[model samples]
Target chain A: MFQPHADRIAKPLLAAAALVCAAVLVLIIAVIISGAWPALISQDLVVFITDASWYPLEGQFGMLSMLLASLLVMMIAILLAAPMGIICAIFIAYIAPVRVQKIYRFAIALLAGMPSVVLGLWGLTVLVPLVNKWSPPGLSLLLAGIVLAVMILPTVALTSLAAFKSLPIALQQAASALGVRQHVQILKVFIPAASAAILSGMLLAMARALGETMVVLMVAGNVVQFPSGLMEPVRTLTANIALEMAYATDQHRAALFVSGLLLTAMVLVMMSFAARIKGHNDYG
Target chain B: MAEHLFQFVIWCVALLVLMVLLWLVYGLLDHGLAKLSFEFLLSEPQNAGRDGGIISILVATLLILAVTLLAALPLGLASAVWLAEFTATHHFWARKVRLALDVMAGVPSIVFGLFGYAFFGIFMGMGFSVLSGGLTLACMILPVFIRTCEIGLRGVNNSWRQGAAALGMPKIKAVWYILLPAAMPAISAGLILGIGRATAETAALMFTSGYVDRMPESVMDSGRALSVHIYDLSMNVTGGDAAAQASALLLLMIIIVLNMLAYAVTDLWLGRRLSNDLA
Candidate 1:
């Protein structure tokens, strides 16, 4: 804490910290590309995407089932989170008193940092057992979906909060001034204006849900085939990689990396898509 | 008439949405409440589905948590201080660079695991030890540290900065001596939250820190953090029957303690001063 020579030391230390953060980022991207590129460039992309069978023993490696399961989880998660997240944001932005809003928002910030393992444990001991009681055996996509919805809620809600705050409050007031009812003002004005942020939030939720590992791995039941319906248990791209990586060797490990490689490419595309939506908001 | 009906519909929607959050809390707590026990805390993993303790995982988890927090705090604060005080806001590139951190936050945890595996585990040849894993975990948690610290540091009033400046202190001194102390409570709040995140991270550690079921002998000893142990136990189902509940309870109890310590330190610090107005 002493500063006799603080100026000289502090500046360089701060610069060095920033440099390490940069190095880590570059390091992460470099590792992913290097690990995955061997599979990406060598194999034909279409056969990987279109073929449903992922049998290592038969020398066939297809990612369709895993991707389908992750997508299914994403679809279900967003279905549950988006509506609630949007509504909660609207309530905080338009309806709640300042004190209440502050409390709610703080609670949400805490939830955002909550560990996935905790949530999965909550699901395993809580939701999975609940589902198990109703069916002969439990563990299904519906259960996983319900768990993930709550998981992604904070991201979507916070993003929607930003969107609602940035919308034209003056226009909202004018609408109310003209006897455009509060709900009418919201539905007609707020939702449309805030769509960009809402969509970005949804995209982010998809990225997270698709990539989520422990929760899905613990609760997803790890069934290898494509899910016939929402209630059937299935394995996701991420969970498959995590579950099998320890035992997987040679082709098995590389195949898993190929899945990771595919997932990384998918997420990169979604991230850029979200960025484009964010950029469009500035011009619009 | 339609507007009135719409308002009713919207309010009902709000109530339903809020109730779902309540249900989630209920689900988490009610199931957890019955199984909470101290015996669970003192045991180690055994036959799948049978009763046992996870003391090793718990110790390693706490050790990694401590290491990551101790390592990340100073760097995080320095970055926040540089951004909120030292740098000019008008630089568009500077703003973009800050925004890039948030984008980094968007990257998946599993992706981070890959990064950690490649760089720390493979490239650096740290070989899946706590040092490599903890460092990787710290990096993953850094975006969180940055965002939380920014929230706290930015909350400091401008008058406080100027008043320190008016007292004939050097500009850096004004920040170091005056503003930082004032911002301390807020930054501590963020630090607590970041530490909590670091403790609970599994994906990032999985790739870097391979599971070692022994006590962490040193920073370099590879160990499985608690979350990964929970995942490992729950999925494989090798342990004995009663142990699952005990293990769950133990994991829950450790996390609850982690949360309380984090909350208590921040709450106490803020209660004496800013009351978390910064966040």
Candidate 2:
């Protein structure tokens, strides 16, 4: 017979541990919001969003440009990565031989696991130079977009592959039996069936691209300007935080926290939206 | 003709994805290999990071990793166990916990850095030390570890639990002896993944663990992490590319080795489990 004392101790201990895990997210939110409280109260919310200039030293903390830069880069990343990722996923799911599929999956996993810093290093040393040849400064919105696309490609591809693989085999068999061509089936049936999951994956990728710091900081040129063109250098909100958090003081520090707060809120929103789509796919 | 072209496009995209991975590895190796030496691994730096071995940085990295694992593993394991066994899938609290973990997982590393700076470095007065950085990383990686571990735990056959109950085994004992052992491969895989994440982190560690490139005498001392060192070398220091590339190579190697170890552990454990079932 089991000792009653053991259950008494183990249950509460495990519960406490779980509570601790949940508390971490709350703690992070609280700290960031509290740190950002100064800017949130002092800076006019309207002006903060409307102002394009970000001269923090001169008391100007307009983050509208950085915010736009973040969104623009993320959009570019998704635009470039989504179709390619879906295609890559389809190739893995339907075209590759079984052994080759395994190898490809492993390679994709390796890519997914690649550190952002290393990718940034590569972008800086190799990609930036190549980009610079076309444009005077290599670090541009376009460059950041490319690096971010590569960063998120694995995420999109893997999730899409899983989505495709999860399709009932009967669907494919029935399609072929009814004289539907493979490409047609993929375009008409398979992708639609997996659309929810694939869409959610892209959303997650967007969130990642939006929040990415090192790659953008290294390759986005950290220029606080509205990117008039793809080749123009721009600073993202994340890059702004990383570049200034060191010497930043008082309201400047608080302003950086506001950037962090904004990023966290955006990511949290996307994550929940993705989770909802995933939940619907699982149940509905 | 259209179908063939479509297929060709897909193939090209796949190849391009593979090429990107190869290009990254090739780029690092091409620039880094000549600089990677035993002496480089064992020595300290001279004139910033331009002329030194990565011994101090390595030590700091290891210490930070140790602190992260030490802080995270117990919490993660317990959280995973509770989620997998104690709570029903549809329970409100369980759903809330899962939601929290998911949101945490999606929060960016830079956000984590800001939180760490605010809470640990300033509020707690840990102030840019290994303890602060490691704790911050522990928080960041907790969701990953817990989710993976929970999946592994849930993947254990329901029959095993039923059989254990039929044999009059205590729940705690059964979990410790049967469930945990069966989940070791997954737990270790999660561990390795978390290690890779923690070690490769730059933004989270940059302000929390600090950018001091000296020998850290204690966890309280600010020390540079390998990833941050690489960032600084490549971005800040003039003529620091050689050491930076070498450091990147080292970090990449560490990640690769950990990944291989994870695979090996999974294979070995799963192989034994298969044989046991057959027996």
Candidate 3:
């Protein structure tokens, strides 16, 4: 129970709490810069962009390939997730009976709530080994993409469900009344209207894939160098930081922070789009 | 004929997507099928990382959730109280603060990890400590706290507020004695979600808390959470393949149960409130 006094003091308390959030941001940025200043100032950002070498002891910290590896993962994962998630939403919203829809929603709720670690373990045992056997070098970018796709499916599915459900129920009924098949009604009416939510969900799913750390750390093979095609082992910024931060020091550690900063920058941009989509959806 | 072609393509895509989702669930079952042992979950990490246990991790997961709740509840509830009961809508700074909190909701966990490592681990000298990780998680999920509480408070009927005011009750007293009670159900679910998020969180904890594979006796003890522990034992033991599989099975079951508990608790609590209103 919150028992606030009827006084200016209560006002000060709120101001103070808000101030704490800013203070946290400031403190975090300061510490990262100070700790990682060596790498930030000494190592050229170009190396991070162009070079493929990432051996920290030798000071070769190029991450262009790793960056691409991450991008490739996000790209493939979204490809795998968005359409299915959209269809799943359609099934739940239009095709399924009420009982099935309830079950689908509950399943989604569980999926959303499941820890990433479990997903990582599943990926490591099932996805990684299967890829390793069929694909060359097995633990390649494609493997990471597939695992990440599953990892983020619930996010995309649930948000798209929200999107499809947000449409006026009459719209679907009207489409059905016009002799449109269930499938046609989905694309012509449901998908278009729900596009914004679907798009935002896709972005959030991509964001989840891009920012995932431990799962990628485990299954992405921890190779910091470039991918030799789709089957080549590679690294991601989140994985790079997670794998090395254990014993990293000086320049090595700061570079990890730089990676973290890069991830946050990307996420901030991604989240703004999420907010914009959410905002536009809210107003609608 | 044109509709048929488009439908063909769409159905092909839909069926492909459906198979992929089923494939995902099958993977979950495949990894976790054999290792659902109560004893394995109750014991500690042992036997050279494999065939040991997940008890330490289970303890750490709950411990982090507890610490996060302790750290966040006071601050979040305080902020919620201000915005809902005390502050004027015309207050520019108050609106800005809420907006900032909303934006904070979007900052990625990686940034929180960096900040946790720097501010709490280094600056605060809570180096690689559980408290640091918990506090970092608290900050990360605070927006959920505020937003949920706002909903709960708003759900309290306006007549309650007016009635309290007419009775010559103090604003602060009214907030505590009347409104919070009515809103308790909604607010409690928010706390549940925050705890769920905290328990499952890893990246933020990865840096601020070192992964000591032992039970934390206090908030300051550095330790690996269940998720981090699962990541470590499974990934770190790739060279010894069998042991990794043993732990993965154990890890998956624990995660399912934990997720279910978190979700059910929130749902039941909220649902009960809604039901009571109907009668």
Candidate 4:
């Protein structure tokens, strides 16, 4: 008798706790939108996309250079990380011995677990100096891209490993029976089978690179410019907010929120795209 | 010859990945370990961290972590229970919850800092306290904690539930006694991972916590997190690199230990389960 009543209370309580997640999401969107309302209404959207100057105090809220910088840095990161990470995953899944594979996986986890700030610290002290020898200024899009690549490599490798592990063993066996070479089988059969999951992983990594703050702030040199080359300094949308948020007020503050809103939208769009791919994979 | 060349390239790539990890670890240890000492761990900063130790920063980090876990753990566990037990997998509400979690998980830490500043600092008026920082971290990490715990709970055998129902066990009672105990390893693993993340965080806590290096009097007091301290010491303070290295080493050790603990918990649990099954 008492147990039934307890169950009734407990079930609803648990559900209410679960509903808090959905509520939090709604609240986040509401808060960001409201914070950004002033700038959103004040400025034309084209100004954000077309104009490159970002002098917030003088009332010019152009973010085009930073926007392009964010995308370019992410592109550099993806271009460098994707092939290397996928190859690492292939080596682990198909080539490495069992003991070696386990160790490699653990190393990858340790890499993933390293704080972003620490990576930034390394980039600041070590990588930046190393790049300075050739580039004159150590902090640039190329250096940031390298740091970001290291940060996201584990994500790509881990996801691709899962993708490979999930393939039907018979597929490999049939390929071998047909006398297909190992490289040929990997290049043709296994990669094609796992492309969707691998693509999703790369997409997630790109989102992470775009949203990354401390690393870029430390190593990207914080110059708000359209980079003409890989070694040129540039600021991302994230770094802009972190750098300016402390003293920004009024329209300046609102503009930071606008940047935040743009970042949130970009990350959400990429996440949803990745989720859709994963969902399609699950069903099809 | 081609196969050999391909194998050589793969081997080189694998070695390169290993070298990166070693290089990072070596870099930190080489620069940091010489500076680390008992006194360094237990003292407070002086002259803007050019001298003295990180005891106050350590306290603030722990207090913030405590507040975060205190808030996030119960909510995360309850939500996981609800998702794994009460809701059907394909239910509309369940899908929405999962979607919300995915969105939350993908959100950048800096945005959480902005949200925390706007919501907790300004609107709610918590204002740069440990409580505000911890709550922001709780929000950021809740999705991760929930997903891990839910996966653990869902991995429980279906027959365990059926058997409980057959034995006339109350749903709550079975979940409390059986399902939770059975899922303890995963739950503990998830908890450790959450703790690791909360400890290593910098951006999300920067504004909400408001970077006061003094020892916090209470949750309401502003406290500087270790990550924030490292960032400031490395970037802002001239000649603060030695102290920053020491602090980074300490933070790195804490995260590595927590991660190892997570792995150990899962492995121990798996070993026990195997032995019991054989018996």
Best-matching candidate per DockQ = 2
Which segments of model 2 are wrong by more than 4 Å? A1-3, A280-284, B266-279
Which fraction of the native contacts appears in each prediction?
Answer: 0.36, 0.71, 0.44, 0.57
Judging by TM-score, tell me the better candidate of 3 and 4.
4
Docking class of 1: acceptable
Q: Against the true two-chain complex, what DockQ does each candidate achieve?
A: 0.40, 0.66, 0.44, 0.62
Q: What's model 1's lDDT at B231?
A: 65
Score candidate 2 by TM-score against the native: 0.96
Which structure is stronger by lDDT: 1 or 2? Answer: 2
Cα lDDT tens digits, model 2, A189-234, are 9999999999999999999999999999998999999879999999
- Quote the lDDT for A239 in model 1: 87
What is the Å distance of residue A133 in model 4 from its true position? Answer: 2.2
TM-score of each: 0.85, 0.96, 0.87, 0.97
Model 1, range B75-151, lDDT digits (tens) per residue? 77777776666656654534654655655676677777777776778788888788888777787777777777766
lDDT of 4 by residue, B96-215 (tens): 888888889898989999999999999999999999999999998899999889988877777789999789887888899999999899899999999988998898988899889998
iRMSD values, candidates in order = 4.3, 2.2, 4.2, 2.1
Local lDDT at A10 for model 3: 57
Model 3: residue A189 alpha-carbon error in angstroms:
2.4
Query: lDDT per residue, candidate 2, B62-113, as tens digits?
Result: 9899889999999999999988877777777777888788889999999999
DockQ value for model 4: 0.62
Clashing pairs in 2: B45-B52
Q: In order, what lDDT does every prediction score?
A: 0.72, 0.90, 0.73, 0.89
Higher-ranked by DockQ: 1 or 2: 2
Q: Among these predicted structures, which one has the highest lDDT? A: 2
